[model samples]
Target: MPLASDPIRALHSLLRSTLRITVTDGRIFLGAFVGTDKPMNILLTETEEFRLGPGENPNGRFVGQVMIPWKMITKIEAQESVVQTRNQLDRDVRAGYIM
Candidate 1:
């Protein structure tokens, strides 16, 4: 399918960006957003997993690439730079500024 819609294009623009994903098990993953499927399963590379359980290491461990099922995800956050860039672009667009 072609990525012709605005939302799809927006998502595409975030490709290779850093994302923080929290799972239902209270573990968080920080990785580069690589891909996603129709089921919303996310694929990430150079990932690190941080477990918040007792006795677990506060410093995240590198987990390499991972594919997270959408059902297990509780929250998703983009890196601050990505969010700020998008926000600024939105503001500029609203102000009739286009590049």
Candidate 2:
């Protein structure tokens, strides 16, 4: 199947199902792909708290929230979902859903 035929599915294939997002301003957030708009903008929820700065001990950790704009994103890392989705898509295409 052409990559553009199913852009959302392609995104589901390309982007991390479990994303580790780092904001340009140096904040780190991780969560499931709750939502997104084209141009790669994203929305993530179910975030956990993380501590900033280079430190040996995590003493000043603060509760973090999800809802960062894509413009603030500096990096995104894909996790287990990459392999899982690829395998699943392969199966689906073999069954003729993706053609």
User: Which candidate comes out best when scored by TM-score?
Assistant: 1
TM-score versus the correct structure, for each prediction? 0.79, 0.60
What are the lDDT figures for the candidates, one per model?
0.85, 0.65
Q: Lowest lDDT 10-mer window, candidate 2?
A: 56-65
Sliding window of 10 residues with minimal summed lDDT for model 1:
1-10
Could you give candidate 2's per-residue lDDT for residues 1-99 as a string of tens digits? Answer: 444466676566754366777888676676766777765677665665454878633443433446667788888765755656676776789799999
> Could you tell me how far off, in angstroms, the CA of residue 33 lies in candidate 1 after the best superposition?
0.4
Give model 2's TM-score versus the native structure: 0.60
Clashes of each: 0, 0
